[model samples]
Target: MTKLTLYNNLKTVRAQQKLSQSKLAEKVGVSRQTISNIETGEFVPTARLALLLCLALNKKFEELFYF
Candidate 1:
């Protein structure tokens, strides 16, 4: 089995939108620590969370996450 690495430009996008980690997390219904983990590649968000992030950030799925 292959171990896949997921990649995201979340920090850049979040900064571009002038949102703090806590703010984005709140909008996406997650905790700030979770957002920090996600940004650092320590956590991978579920499908629902991904969609929520897109809705909140006005980004496409591909534009945010990929593996």
Candidate 2:
């Protein structure tokens, strides 16, 4: 099976919305470093966290993350 890489436009979208990593993290109930990790591809968020991020950013899952 082929491995799929997850990619996101999180930083761009967050910047466009004028949200700081800390602020977004707070909204999603995670630490600022967690948000940084996700943005840098050092960590992939859990399904629940992904959903929370989507809700917090007002973005669809596909809009935030993709293969």
Candidate 3:
């Protein structure tokens, strides 16, 4: 199987929205470390979480999680 590469778009999206990691985490109902892990490519979100993130960031799912 092709290992999915988790890219760090959290920082960019947060910056664009003028929000902090904690703030975004609260909005997404996840821990700040979870956000950090996603941002650092240490964790891969589930399909639902990925969709939530895309919606929160006002970005496309592909844009947020794909290459």
Quote model 1's TM-score: 0.93
Residue pair clashes in candidate 1: none
Candidate 2 matches the true fold with a TM-score of 0.96
> Which one wins on TM-score?
2
How would you encode candidate 1's per-residue C-alpha lDDT over 6-53 as one tens digit per residue? 888899899999999999999988899999998999999898988999
How far does residue 38 in candidate 3 sit from its true spot (Å)? 0.2
Name the regions of candidate 3 deviating beyond 4 angstroms: none
lDDT, model 1: 0.93
Candidate 3 lDDT for residue 62: 65
- Judging by lDDT, tell me the better candidate of 1 and 2: 2
- Tens-digit lDDT track of model 3 for 1-67: 8876666566787888998889889988999999888888888888888888888888987677665
Per-model TM values vs. the true structure: 0.93, 0.96, 0.84
What is the clash count for each candidate, in the order shown? 0, 0, 0
Tell me the tens digit of each residue's lDDT in model 2 across 1-67: 9988888889988999999999999999999999999999999989999999999999999999999
Which runs of model 1 end up more than 4 angstroms from their true locations? none
Considering lDDT, where higher is better, how would the candidates rank from best to worst?
A: 2, 1, 3
lDDT comparing candidate 2 with the true structure = 0.94
